[model samples]
Target chain A: MEGLNTVGLVEVLTLDGLDDVVRVLRDQGRKVIGPIVRDGVITHDEFDSVSELPHGWTEDQDGGRYRLVPTGTDEVFGFSSPSTSWKRYLYPERTLLIRARRDNGTVEVVQPQPDAPAVAFFGIRSCDLVALGILDRVFLDREATDPTYAARRSDVFIVAAACNRPGKTCFCASMDTGPTPRSGFDLSVRELHGDGRHEFLVEAGSERGTELLATIASRRATTADLDTAQALHGRAAASMGRRMDPQDPPLAALDPDHPRWDDVANRCLACGNCTMVCPTCFCNATEDSTNLTGTEAERWRVWDSCFSIDFSHLHGGSVRSTVKSRYRQWLLHKLVTWHDQFDVSGCVGCGRCITWCPVGIDLTAEITALATPQQSAGRKGVPS
Target chain B: MTPRMYEVVARRDDLPDTVTLTLAPVDEQCPTPAIGQFNMLWAFGIGEAPISLAGFENGHLIHTIRRVGAVTNSLAASTTGDQIGVRGPYGTGWDLTRAAGRDVLVVAGGLGLAPVRPIITELFANRSSYGRAVLLVGARTPDALLYRDELEQWRGRLDIEVEVTVDSATPSWRGDVGVVTRLVERAPIDPENTTAFVCGPEVMMRFAAVSVVDRGVPAAEVMLSLERNMHCAIGHCGHCQLGPEFICKDGPVVPWPRVKPLLRVAER
Candidate 1:
């Protein structure tokens, strides 16, 4: 901590050292939120003790399928991200934009400042962390900065978890987002289980993380420990169930009349589940609510999806009306058009949409459909 | 973080369901709007809508709004001296520099004439900067025509070619009758050197673009002001997304070929 580089300082952490890290985070007035196994899914939530982590449970995720399987591993983090992303925190589904009160002569418009809580993300997955980075570019780096996102993102600490065991729906390797996040983390923790011992190899990725790790780092990592940790991440990378075409641009340069769009549209419900769970999809619509008496009014920004008909609503009607058009918009927006706007693909390959989708429509397959010539008899059934 | 306070100084009924309101900034400084640029007008207790600058009479900012939805209804209903909020003279506008020595072709259909009003204002102010100018206007009916008196006065000018058409004309009407596209023959423009600007309903713009393009104007030389679902009049809100472009940020005014394929889309 005294004279260390602000980034990339790896250290060994024991079971007790993990507890110390959480304690230090909380002691600094930051609300520590981590993973907890509840009801059947491993979800990110507020937790104080490391004991709350899904200890021996790993998630099995296929297209339109998810299950909390008992992996029998005594490691803390054994699952990838759930349907919930850090977008819930950084960019809330519903955010208050403006508040107005009818004065004696005129309406006093009040654009309210956000109430940002000092919090630390305790167990952010590499995929979700990548999603946060994309959100940062959209909300912070854009022309009109979203004050709500800036407020929530400014003071929060990110303690990301390297994917030791990638979930069944994960394809971070294809997207080049993870099994290991490149940047935008205060600290990153990788879990390792070897010849009869379980331990964590934590790395301080920022100045604050370095300072915090000074108190919790049990020992500096030896060569053998580093190799074990690297192997674990390599295994997770190789084990992804889905593989998007990292070679071919996801949906770049698509023909407007591509038949693949029609095929996917037939299966797509247009329910907006993909956009809702997707880590990088950031389309939204604002709603205005007024209390009784019609004196005070408030405007709130709610998460809207490209799949929703009203997402592209104009003066007379919606811009994208048909399911085929809606799906086309979503796919093109995420894969191709997003590159033109943000200079990056919108999807992080987290696969929340793949698992959460009730119809089991996979972008990997859809993108492949666009590339491959249509077969005489198309492959049958959804990816479940 | 507060919206600039502005008061409506004057209101002119341009057509049925359409009014041109002139606004004067109160304590806030409003930037001079370029032709084809728009402002997000906020109605107290209601919401905001992006309306194009329709030129100014004196020093006030003018916006011609058609009562389409909620925000516009509030604006269209606003009386003179009523208070309203304003933000942005946002997005890139029509580059008059590109059309500097070239002929200028302005096409307007129905309320689309409102946004192009600024261009006409600019043309009249600097009559010699541009080459031959023509304004082709189309309306659903003779009664639906906007700024009828202004159109008559402008037509009197020997400098500009102003041809007006109606889809359905009355017996008393003496001018051209038929679609605005048909008037391309009447307003003989040197398409090679003419830069066309179109604003209207999507279908009208599409047909107008085709006719203008057929008249020897390149597709890229023809620009159209687009309408998309814009929430944040910046790039943040995804509502205004059109293919690779954000109608709010990248355009509102864009070259035809950039959005040509997208315009062919039924829903989007």
Candidate 2:
């Protein structure tokens, strides 16, 4: 393939020097956002300094629960992962497509105002990097190009941070999307605090990243730093708290009379919170509104979830009226049917769904409920 | 085609709860939609929903709409020559040419017959060229039957077989009293050389598919129109997704075997 531009790399700043990198990126007209400990969780936030980031913060999650606490080290980069993902950056909760105004007898549609500056997402995790790639496949496919997702994606530059600590809810190792990012990033960093010196193993994947790196001041990496980074990734890989069977069975492989879905649905609130935090969920609903003039009309698009009853509403009634049906659709689409439609699995196993759901519904547990039916007494002689 | 605002045309209480509206087309050709395609009809203030193309007798495209949703309720109450904007003819349509030499079995239930009527008209226009043509229709009541005038005209044809049944009947009625699938059982068909097309509610279509195939009609020879929520008439929006196929493009009209798996899945 013809290269857009040649790739280059430089070691200009330490891990703590990310503040200076953010400052430079901001001056270059990019929206810089990253993880910060807030409200007892590591969530996405705007930051301007190393102090603003979640320093030595780590998250613990079990089922539908998440908590953020300070790690016992002064090493600022100590964190497993954040609950809020990069999806909120690429696909916001809602966006306006048009706002209209009435002129004479005719209606004039006014396009939505220009977008904010392109973003340079900082401290992006490897699983999130894989998540972004998944979203790209869905939203940027030739048949259905989502302009809203595209606009946010194209302008953004990714700065992926290699994971040194794996979260308890994370199954990235099994999902093949974590511990280390293979591609789909501009720059990747491995922060190492060593004997009398703090350094980061920074690599540029793109020309823009190389140019930005050249502006920073730092020394070349010794063979030791490279080894350290590799070892850190290896440790993170082994430290993964969860694992899932990557066996991609067809969704039609599911037994209709399994009786597990109904049991799971009883606990599901249908709040759609799991989908909201998931980096790969891209279902949307379109809304049309008229201005006060009543003549001019505008159309807007917002994120929609399959969990909602209204999402399946037809002429007279909803196709899937019950919570069981909605939950089944979500699981089947994510694991099985989405592969049929998009030629890719809909999830990266980033653990957002497990942590953010109001009822800590573990996808792995649900899959286990189906995969090993004989293990559970609930499956015996029960109707779906 | 891009969506645009449109004024409503005349809407009258043509049948008890049904409204017959003449939609003003936004495009030049009045969007010469194929037989099984549908349009996303919308009222100005109310919401928009998919409605089948019932008839195109005049310059005004005729739509037999039931007063169901907010959009249709508002449309039912519209006046003469009122304006309504329409977008579509979206989704796959019937392959009329492919079924040319075979016996045609057109099975429809209630409002489902409205979308199938156009193809029946197209076939009748060239009546001599095709083989035996039969229309088996079913409705909840005789009053709920669509296109009474057209059904009468079809019943009088020498070459066509017309059979209609209702789930229940009135005291004055003297016709088949059973489910629509029962009419399919009674219709004389050369199953080996016949093509059956069904359009109705999901349950009705499923039952009809069984009835058609049980009579010896090949599963592949049966056609069905599947319904799903559609946001963008083009396939860009994911709302109308039915398995791997987009109901907006791949179908509304899909062969029985092709969509059989999706029929069993609840949320699709």
Candidate 3:
């Protein structure tokens, strides 16, 4: 508590002190959401106590696979990534825009009020923090802001957790997004376990974080603790299971008729799982519904994917009707055109699209395949 | 954003399936739309569709809609006094100032003609500001033509030239019968000073744009209005993306060079 007066002040806390951190946030009228074991997988949900956190649990994630395993050590905040990203909370799956009623001979329209609450996001990883910034660029920092996403994102507080144990599907080091929490959080915690000790190194990143840290019982962090945290982060960064060249090939230059697309299309189901789990894919469609009396109606915006045939529908028919075309759009939009649109790469190397893909379509492998030279003889009988 | 209320002042059947409606705001006035821009019209219990401004008459917005989907069908069924939700004057518009003191070539196919009606009207209103003006229109058949009376009236003018073409014709038809690109090939105009505005189906625009550029018109001087599935006309919805461009925000109207390569890619 003596070291909590300034930003960037490091403090040490016990496992019990971490529980008090959650208690203080809840006392300040913030809904606390963090990692919880639900449906046999680590996911995010609102919880009241630290006991709800997925302690001693980590996950094994590879292309097309995910399994939660207990590490036999009671180390909280040990998970690499959740099954879904924080976009589900900030940009919800569905939001109502307007409600209209037909009365007598005229129609009346009413704009729906946004349902937003002050939330404290606990255990958010560094890549997801970068994803939050990308979503902000798409929704808030634009010509016209999405009022619903703006309302939800305005009053949220972030408590980030450093990923000292990177997952097998993680490549955030290559994307330069994580392993250690660098910015965009009010408070950051690194779990230090081993040597018969279970403690956390907490740092204050904002004034509000300093005030909250002052209320809890903690001691100033020693140089040895800081060194241990740095060493662990360095080890995590060097041991990422996946790798991608940050300088990607210009995807637009690749031939649209490349045979690799056909090979991927044969395995791709267009099931849209990758879009749903992705933290930054922001396509949506509107749904209008009427009551039985036909007097009341509401328009709701729901999540949509480019892989769907109807995403490109026009007066005559769908534009990207073929599976090959849809897949190509998804790949090019994510890797190449996103820079033209947002001035940044759309992918943060979270690897959710690879793990969640039913057929294990690794994007990094696909990029390699597309970049490699192929023999012209193989293209003779390829289907368009 | 929520839509403002607009009441239908009048409706006319342009064809068996196409209806043109005159909409006037009930209270708050909607922003005036430029030639190539469009509005997201909401049919009370249905949904919204982006419809371009056909023209303006007296102060009301003229929208020519062909019944194709759920929202358009509901919009087409509305009577004179019915109220509907309307928003936007969204997307880029045709920059007429770019054509000052230049010959103008207008090419439209089928319902694509609706988006360019205002362009033709603006040209005639300031006839002295521009050089020779020609309009070429193409439809599937003789009976499918839009603005038949207006075309006849324009054909009578000696100051401007108007030509109509059909894919097929009956015995009584005497006009040109072929794809609209043929009109671009044989139109008597100096390509050095002509600015062309082309809009229609994607395939039609592709061919027409190529033909215009082939005739020595600069690709930068040729404009084409694009159509795509849109939800949030403000560009938050990602359905209208073509390559890196969001058709709803960056354009419904774009210069030819900007979209030529994108159009060449199948299903882009």
Candidate 4:
């Protein structure tokens, strides 16, 4: 009752308006970033026009494997979500925290004011919006708000493209964040096209989106169009190949001696790739880099992973010295202790960890194993 | 608040690699720090490290730093007139007021005494409020002992019992020998009515905690300071996490029962 914000307005858009969403956001003085193929991978980066969008591209994503293949249909939102998350834009990997310039006698130390430019997303997925929400709770919800993240997140405008083509690795249904997001975005778009028809069912979740949708010229959606969109969504939800239980017993609570722990440990290299790609992992460490003459120094907060042995280092030595211990900490932290710390779940089940991991670790299988003692014991070898 | 400029008013080399820097803010009034809470001291060109407030006297705050790494070494090397930056009187502090009318047992090992020092000062300043107070300190050797003169003054007090022990002492050394945990067994205090505060290396704290708990002191009455790799005192950075708790914000001074499970796991 006290701290909640008033809900944003809602509206619907016609099919043709999907192409103009970026232009509308840009006219509002916001820089736009969207999906693009870079170095043979579908990733989110700065883009100028819709032509730069990865058209006709769909991704083949399995555990530890990802490939961008052409779908033969000219579709922009056909692919799975990328390896990079909205965190790269909102809660940037590197941030300048403090700067101390030493003159002759006095040292002027200032908390550097963050320069945040308003940015809009062209095609953010529902899982990404959920990840952003989780980050908001961590940074903005706390008493000591992270000044950097708060400044950047304030003016962010999101345009979410609902997942109609779920990736092989996608498990957003299990995480309860998507194939479709109920709310938590400025605008929602379901790109429905096939068999000589090309259109998008756009729904506004915020006043900004409602105003922007009014600028694009398109007809009101017929009842038939809405029915077609609903059928497409139902089919997509069923097509999702991956599934995970966020709170599977023994593993979700992370029973330490569960034999599966040792099996996962043996396969886990502790390379930190999973954490790097995980949408909800927010661990960071601060470092100070001094100038050559050493008169001035700047404190930088950098991206850090729990898998690194140096992460748990205290005075004597690392608390998690072995690969087994480190892997245990990372998984336990994600599935179990994170809930204890944040109240909300840490994972959005985007499956980036599964697709990006070099060792092909699937969290869905890991969670399923914890269902029974026999299953945990049976899965001894790492999935190929 | 961000770190403001502070000058090293005076410096004292208490031991070979340990030094105490008495700091005073260059401009504004620095707030009084609480017992068991720490300050993130920045060494001009080097990084910041969290050091417990050793003492607060007159217009200066004293921090006894051990030169273990780059940041602390730079801070320990700093002399009078050198300027450094300080922020935060951060994290939770000891609950000395709750220990009123109860015997207070203070156990410290080596640099661990730095954090427990403030509690001792508070106990002495308001001696009538609390029951009998006992301080048992332990170090690696006789030379490693800190605050020699103040320890003498505390020993002279009729109201307090101060005992010092070193693992190995020089031939000239004269005091108790062995670990501080051993001293807790024979310490003069009412165990049932006593509150124990411990700060030390993790192994030593665990043993000291067991000794006090075995003496009939409830586990809830035992307070221990947890140390970790603290990068941010405000708890944004994830370096200081111990299980679900962040050592910087949730603790540095947590009740033993609260952290007992976290402390029990070797590599959690």
Candidate 5:
């Protein structure tokens, strides 16, 4: 209860002040990772320099399209969120589980090394934060707490920046993931503009964030600054170009034979780009590794996607052979059934699936297409 | 010093296409496994597969496997003295203590027999502790029934009722010819004093649960072993998740009432 009510706030930072914050976090031995402009698209990658940050950049996205363009402002946090997220730092692409050696007609079992990296993930959005919370239901629940995920998660701190600008594919408002996060972050910042000056309003949500904020050179927030922060959030909400049906049973509308799935399957590449960029998708596959000596071998687990044909393979054949079935499974599991299974909706409404998809397979559009007649007639064909 | 891995000492081609392998712990003292639990058996160079204990608890561990996947096909190809690694007898198992003093109904359909067989053996070993024991087994055909010779021995015992059936049958075979649920309909069970455990295909268990519940058995009194794609026996892997309950943890043995909602969904 103490964690819920204790909202901490502070003086806003200008665009130029971001480098100082990164320096302070890195000086504390944290690996700072964020969206960096690469090959024309803003993507998540390791960063040590403020120059690598996507400054004066904006993304254009629609069903089956994504593009990076120059924004008129020099503000580093002025742009909308990226298509990728911070889940990669918690659950990597691959990691070893066990190693074994056979000698003298006997075998030995060995445990793999644990991750101990302290991470400071910058530019995390509210939807991505909610996605992490849904994942926490799986990886950190009482029955099966993933040690690898837990180790990385506990050592990390989040520096979530609120959405000042939303892309065409953005829909965090409908999902309530937001223009602002309710919980699951150490710190959140809302960028504000006042009389030709840009400033970031800061709020600490956890003790780790409180400690990190203590090192930052900032005074406490005034009532007027709070009003400015609220006004900034309202502007972001008004600018939202995408919205999902807040009332629609979150991803549950996707049926195996849903006509909407057939529509997307036609343009979809089955390249798994959507899942790769998704912050909450946690399906994985395993592999066995052998050392050069042939005497030592290790078992490894790696991220996998349901879009792959082999993801649901049975003995003689694959259960979901077509792109249609795979897409249906992905959407339904993320939205509807996940609620029944895990008591949480799988999607955080980050809009990354809509943005990064090469063919621009918009999830919100598909859901709208599948929306029941009563909802469609009343809600103007789109939930958002 | 390293932890010792178990090795397959002997392999017996038991029923048609089914092989029984004996595993001996590499260490002098083997970690004892529990009834209704399973091991992640890995072929030396291939991969791992989950297999239930067919014979063990008397010390010599045995696994009855049917050649199904890449790992299983390779495991079936192993010689009598081939070596492999064993991880766990993980997850919560059948609470045999809960079944004590009650008449127990142990139903198996095809390969489902392997997982619950050890529980039957344990039940028989402590025969007087329970009221009565019944085993109703159904396979695809006569040739597919596992533990045939053992079935005969259990049949002769006065303490247990053992019956076999097949969905389809050969001309020479003269056993009950119907689905396993048909056998359940004819059997007389005192639902108040009985606890039924069902394992097999989802359809078989679904039908069997209907029959058991019709006989006045409470939903909590009937248990089913679910089969899911369990890559990691540890609860961490989401592959085996069925609702909030991880099939690998909350159960591979769950009360019918607990899993009814999940079973309705197509994905699970």
Candidate 6:
């Protein structure tokens, strides 16, 4: 592995050689988490062997639907994205912040140290990669860093997977975040298939990636292989199932009282599924609980959604009590207010929100409906 | 940030459900919060709530808490010598320097006066530095008024104009009985020269802010403190978000023009 100028070095590896990459990372005492078939659907989980990878399986994702389909071919990175992104690993659903115990008359407070382990994330999609960057800005690039998120995010080995077959709900191309890995990765893998030949084109994006690649048995890529990889990326980019207008006025500028909000509220469930599935939605609430004896207590940070009626609760009552207001807040926050807060759009065009919403409400379509003046004028006075 | 232990040294019942507890750090001194800044008061096994610094006495942090929720109920119920966790001095504070040579108009309703009490204290301490100063306070009823003694003392001072009003009055009550906005409407001031600070329930704030603006004060010159469901009190927790601003960090105090559009949007 020594003396290898790994950065930007592209190489071709067979299916067997691809398995060695996971072996090498595991040998280095890192937890390797990647896409796997779980409950007849693709989801991320920890695996020690490459055989656990969801080979020859693809996902069919559309508005309010998801299903796994088996492809009669050995394609390790066939799925577009799993049900969840790497967020569950980087920022767990729940974290213990502090614990306390009451002595004879005084209370003693103790802050619990964050539990973080070095992890290698395999087969990360490009849209989710951008989502990680967005999360970094939220948690790390601030005056006070979230200790739990910082600890887990500090030591991560990212292996990006370039998409070849974009999903039915994917719009990463319109978001300008996908089809091909751009940056912020240690290594990137592109699976190529055609003409009775199947292989993986792996490229070292960082020095560590190059060294790791040198440990595995692989041959340097030729010009023909590079051309084939570029063509596949081009095809993937053209095959996006949805598109958003880059010139669409910032959703913040849309009328807050637009009739379209009422229209969407009619079908909205206010279940907060979109926020849960979204890679960058970072709202959370803290809970304090005590033991039966009332002597020991713990404080925990749990993910919370703005859609909950209690999210905007003050002394008198909830500020946003109706489903219309909550749904408006979620949409406006993602497409409009997020840019003002984070200097980046919260929606990465991953379409997880569209696919997971129980009512099949597509934000892209909603944005268009809200942007159209005639549609709003035509729907005025329509009861929700 | 982890909360540091603070021992409640003194407690004063301001109202039936409200108490002002003066806390002294068990070991090191916690950072002194500026006027309008707040601290996350942790009630041992209850939880944490963002409480504004009502005042500071000698090195102790003073917080006036009203029992509105579980955490506040616990905090309000705490007696002297009870130890609680405290973390903060968070959020943007009132820039009193902006009011140095200007006429100051402070309008507070209900418990909102707690956050601006320090500002009022500073204005009285540095009386000659500012022009005409006026304070208008309102409560749901006469019994619900906070800082009753302090309001009486300020009313006696001839230099500052102090008006206290209640939504409903007892038969013996002689003070004004109306919303605080009525006082805002009739306050004696050069509209162009006055900087107004208003805080209260959201509806009260909106009406009071509009009244202040109607009195010809620039929207930017009118400052209001906001409240949201805050978990971390830092910007990381997204609960306190209001449009582009994080109420816990960017403000609990913000200029009116910046949040005017947001306030117009109901439930934003």
Best by DockQ: 3
Point out the higher-scoring one by DockQ: 1 or 5. Answer: 1
Candidate 2 stretches greater than 4 Å from native: A1-12, A74-76, A100-116, A194-197, A248-252, A289-297, A374-384, B9-12, B26-32, B55-61, B233-246, B265-268
Cα lDDT of model 2 by residue, A113-210, tens digit: 53655888888887888778878887787855766777888878888777777888888888888777667777777777646656677777787887
Q: What is the i-RMS of every prediction?
A: 7.6, 4.7, 4.1, 7.3, 8.1, 4.8
Kindly report, for each predicted structure in the order presented, the TM-score of its chain A compared with the true chain A.
0.93, 0.89, 0.94, 0.91, 0.89, 0.94
Ranking by lDDT: 3, 6, 1, 4, 2, 5
Question: Listing every candidate in turn, what is its Cα RMSD in Å to the true structure after a full C-alpha superposition?
Answer: 4.3, 3.9, 2.9, 4.4, 5.2, 3.2
Q: Write the per-residue lDDT of candidate 3 for residues A153-187, one digit (tens) a residue.
A: 98888888998788888999988988787878888
Q: What is the DockQ of each candidate?
A: 0.48, 0.39, 0.60, 0.43, 0.27, 0.56
What local lDDT score does residue A36 receive in model 2, on the 0 to 100 scale? 79
Q: Of 5 and 6, which scores higher on lDDT?
A: 6
Can you give the lDDT of residue A331 in candidate 5? 76
User: Cα deviation in Å at residue A335, candidate 5?
Assistant: 2.1
Q: What overall lDDT goes with each candidate model?
A: 0.82, 0.75, 0.88, 0.81, 0.75, 0.87
The true-versus-predicted C-alpha distance at residue B89 of model 1, in Å, is 1.5
Ranking by DockQ: 3, 6, 1, 4, 2, 5
Q: How far out, in Å, is residue B243 in model 1?
A: 0.5
In candidate 3, what are the lDDT values of residues B63-126, reduced to their tens digit?
9999999999999998899997889889999889999999999999999999999998999899
Docking class of 4: acceptable
- Candidate that beats the other on DockQ, 1 or 6, i.e. the better one: 6
State the weakest 10-residue window (summed lDDT) of model 4 chain B. Answer: B259-268
Tell me the interface RMSD of model 2, in angstroms.
4.7
lDDT (Cα, tens digit) per residue for candidate 4, span B1-268? 3687889999999899999999988987467877788889987767889999998888688999998888898899998898978887888899897799999999999999889999989997999999999999999998888887788899998989999999998998889889998999999999999999999998798889989998889889999998988877776777788878888888889998888766666566
Model 6 chain A: weakest 10-residue lDDT segment is A375-384
Candidate 1: pairs in clash:
A319-B267
Question: TM-score of model 5, chain A?
Answer: 0.89
Q: What is the lDDT of residue B205 in candidate 2?
A: 90
